[model samples]
Target chain A: MIQKKICMLGGFAVGKTSLVRRFVSNVFSDQYQTTIGVTVEKKCVTVASQEIMMVLWDLYGEDEFQHVRDLYLRGSSGYIVVMDGTRKDTLQTALALQQTAANTVGPVPFVSIINKADMRSEWEIDEHVIEQLRDRSWTVLFGSAKLGQGVDELFLNLATQMVQRPPLSNTHP
Target chain B: MSSDSGRSLPNSPTSEGFTSREEDWTQLRTLLLAPEQTQLDELRERLDHRMVHSQEVSQVLPEAIAIRGVGDQQLSNALTPYVENGFIAAVRKSPRAIVDAIAPIMGPAIRQAIARALQSMTQSLNRSLDESLSIRGLRWRLEAWRTGRPFAEVVLVHTLRYRVEQVFLIHRETGLLLHHVATDAAVVQDQHVISGMLTAIQDYVRDSFGASPDQTLDQVEVGEWTVWIEQGSQAYLACVIRGTPPASLREDVHDALAHIHALHANALADFAGDATPFKATQPYLESCLLAHYERPPKQGALKGWILIGLIVLGVVWWGWMAYQAQSRWSHLLDRLREEPGIVITQARSMWGDYHIEGLRDPLAKAPTALVIEAGLNPATVKMEWAPFYALDAPLVLARAQSILRPPESVQFHIEGGILVATGSASPDWAREAKRLAVLVPGISQYRDDGLVTASISALLDRINRTVIHFPSGSSTVEPSERVALDTVAAILRELDQLVSQSSQRVHLEVLGWTDATGPPARNLQLSQERAEAVVAVLREKRLDKAATVVLGSVRPLDQGGSNQESANQRVATLRATLTAQGQDSQTADP
Candidate 1:
């Protein structure tokens, strides 16, 4: 059995907390309460016939709280950069946070999540955009926090990937 | 003595031997009449003399004498007859045996009687005169004092009737008055008399003096009298007549004194040194000198300063207002220049819509053509064009005419992908030209031939090549990919007219694809996420979102080889489909 820590990061009010709540608790809350500092949740699953425990660190979604992001990512096996699917500006903030995590915690597996998929009518994300980002080594996922759809599978698959290629320094004791 | 004369004298014991009874009666009558007549005659003589000598004294003397004679008229009149008689007759007639008999005894008695009468008369006359004169002088002096001329060298004296008193003398160098008292008489021994006379003299001098150097005098009081002596440039003399001497006699004394003093002053004027008593008092006289010689003029400089201040203030205020107006106008001009195209478009659209009803029938004669045939008349359709910037006049006029009527004739031309439609419709050719313009995309430059057509599909294909992609829900560029996205937004904006003509809403499909490295569920999610990211970038460019749709696929088996696999698997495809609301099918596809 192996354990992995993962971090969620994005701009304030960009669905970072909602996505984390959807992935960890398997439930969605319409009312958005801003994350205060870091909320850690654990979920166990079977990947490649091995039991894996994921310590998901949902961080406060404000650029001002970036000082504390490295601390949360200290033992993270992977990271998920979450952003509002309809906001083009928030996507930049998401990528910035991802870059920060990468530089501070060394190279780690990470995926970009475009949440709030139920708003597809107003969804502005397209294929050429995903291909363009793919060149940067970021995997993309879409989910709707309000409908509790595609929420669990996004994290479950990330845990499996982490188990297959775990970080060389798993310092968490 | 005659019995009648003896009987005339009283039978008193003291008078019985003093003189015979007849002598006593005659002497008594003579004594009474003579003394009275003599005193009265003296007063009359003084009064007459004063009248001839000084008009001022004469004016008041008659009234004074008349009042003094109130009690002694009979005695005073009887003196007339006796004076008319010979003095020799009285001496020869045994009137106490002439000088030896009457000289010693009668002399003392006559002297005493005369003294008493004169003293009483003077006291009575002067008391009344002094009171009236003092009150009148005080009133006049107070008036002068209020006018800032509280002091002077000479004053008109009521006591001397109309004559003026000289009370001040000037020091040589300073030209100031040195002494302030009358100068004609000697200094009085009695303080009370001197003080009263001094006060009257001062009041008179201060009221009459004109503050001129020529009228300056030195005055002093002497025993119930005032004396004024000319000094400096002055040659006039003044005297105050007092005592119970006849008014005529007093006038004579005053005349004599004034004449003598005038002579003396004139004679000594040249001999008097700068340090003479008169010259030492010039400082005191300076203040009373005419104001013209002492004060300087200041009005010219004061007026110039005020005028300069007013001019400066006026200029400052005018400049401030002009600057404010210029700034306000500049702001308005900036707003107008920033959105010129939008303002022009809105105006043209409104004008076209306003006359739409009249241009519905193509067979009807064009309103503009009819108006032109009727001698260049303007069309009835009202048009208003408000351009944010100054617009070309020919363009606006042509546009207005085309809106009013469509042409019937047709011509054709083609350049690049632009289709120029020009023709006259019965109503107007504007609607057909506008329709053709809307259909042509990338018509950057064009010339109208009146009829032409071009393929719009080729334009959309060109636009597609410029379209770029982003990571799903991310603003981060995948290095070297931003150029494509920028081009796409620019081309879309450029071809906005063609796009708008097909349908206001263009349904955009963003197909997100994922590499084979992820599981089915995750891959599907990733694909959808990628599709959303592309859509977001489009919306940021102000693309119509209601016209947008996203489709994603997770074909893990479709992965390519090596570096190409990541690029091919993660690629997103954009497709725009034009559709109208409530329509089951779309017309245009790209």
Candidate 2:
């Protein structure tokens, strides 16, 4: 079994862990539990009829307090950069962390999940940002782990990308 | 030197001329001869003064001759080197005079050197404190160790800790806080205010004393907060930190500034106070969140001991709980052994679960129920015993009572395999007792003939009105009405289940009514269909199996000019009544 490493990078409380748990366990909780321990989870996904085991690293949220360690992204196949749909500032943090991860591990495949899609009333991320990301050939999705919506498709597509994309060069700063 | 003499001759011949040709010759000759005679006398007197004064008077004479515009450049040039040489000779003879002359300037310089030496001594002495966890502190300790400076400095360096609370990327020229990321908030005051103040202060420092352009405020410590400022040509990154941060954070600030400059050089260089492009440096700014720390080596040792202590305590507590459980179980075993004609086959307790099996005498009361009195739940203690033929009616009743465990509201007696239960019970308890009675060994029949339900007449007489309502003419249940219908269905199920266990069988009569708005036949049909719809919903919920759904026809529920009354009339109602036995009602309640 080929085990691929992936990272869930985002700002604080943006449902990165929630989305991963929902994908791995098919369960979601309403509690806003910040992920402080248990960095990664392993789940086997069958992509293209081949079982690919995914090791997902739920990196520390990039907020005013803590930043994701670049050591956590070494030799990874890909990552999912998450942003809270309700906070517009977190988008900048997500984009910046994405750039750093690219610099650290070279550019692997990545997608953006604008989480809390169920909270349409409190949404703050503009559609133009999503459109801009889409224009850059980036896969953008809207999801709500609470409602068990779009969480599986996002991870499954990433799994497929991990299998299909060519391996990146080993040398990364 | 020559021009004046030539001009004097012209003046003598033209302006002050001689009068007669022979007399003019005599006057000119006398004038020229007289000026020569005056020069001859002055030279003779100066020669006598030079002879008396020696070379000193001659050197003074050149100086006097070198007075402004009195003599030409050549004459002044001759005296310049002479005066300069004389001054040098005098300074060489007594240099102390020059030194004393600049006493005011040298006074501060000498004192400053002494002060600097003293400050260095004090810094080395004071930095020998037992605690200071800064990069400077690290170097201090290293210096103390490598050079054998002091032990206290080593200790001091081991104690300091610092964290970068926030980093702000500000335009150097405009001082706009373009982007900021912090562990805490960036600034208590407005970021713009702080940035503007920083610019004002920087500008003031630059302009105030005409200090060197290279001079810039490097570190600003305000109480526990330290702002390490790293200025670039285009921008600066000010790290708001606490404690003394490491040198790496400064390097990080420098690297981040350089990276920002490289990326947005044009934007920062020509920044119009627009923060949009500067936001591109947000990622690099977050690198300032890195913190440097140094804790005492004893902390790890202390933590180890605490962990060991906790583990020891946990083991003790666990062993104590196990000991208590064992003693209690052994006491229980002792009591069981003391019982008459009882043989203990197997009895032990492990992991808080007790298992006991023995041959119990029929006459001795089973102590299984007594296990609960010992602060233990009897259900957790598994007890099994073989039956013996020492049976009696009272024993049979006891067995049935133990198995059924009827509520205090209920009472019952057993005769042979037939059990008669009576008293008052809520519909659920009554149903539970009825079901539980059959499970008692040797009991074939069960009865609750004497049980009187609590105010059953009140329940039957009252009609559950407006429990469910249909939209104006629709037969479908609205989403909001399902909650009320769910409650209604629960009550019906309990009623049906209770009646099934009782001697009297009861079922709900679900009726739907419609207001008189159409022809009587149509209203009747509409009302009938609505009732059927309500019945179908109830059946779908599986609330009751016994329900006699009837169409309670069109009643004029409202006067002309009111929609509320009409809506109220378009509703479902339920009435509970004793169902006929063996009627095989089409609506069977569960």
What TM-score do all the candidates reach, one by one? 0.23, 0.24
**Candidate 2 wrong stretches, greater than 4 Å:** B1-590
**All candidates: CA RMSD (Å):** 63.0, 43.3
**How many steric clashes between backbone atoms does each model show?**
73, 12
After superposition, candidate 1 runs with Cα above 4 Å error: A1-173, B1-477, B494-496, B499-503, B515-518, B544-570, B582-584, B587-590
lDDT of 1 by residue, B1-590 (tens): 34455564666466557467557567776775777668877778877796555766678878876774543333444555676576768766866667786689779868966875686577546544433344344665675577655322112222223222223432222121223333222232432223222323333353345334344335555653445443323322233333222334334434443443454464334321111343333323222211011111247546755887898889998788656544433443334334223221221112112221211122222334433343321443342333232233333333333443323233333445343446322212344555545333334333454433323354346544443444433434464765666565544543443445456554455666665665668767777776666667667777563344445343444645565555555656666555568342443333
Weakest 10 consecutive residues of candidate 2 chain B by summed lDDT = B68-77
Candidate 2's residue-wise lDDT over B123-213, tens digit each? 5465455235544456766778897856563453344477677777766643546777765323355455465456545655555555665
Alpha-carbon lDDT, every model? 0.51, 0.69
Docking level for model 2: incorrect
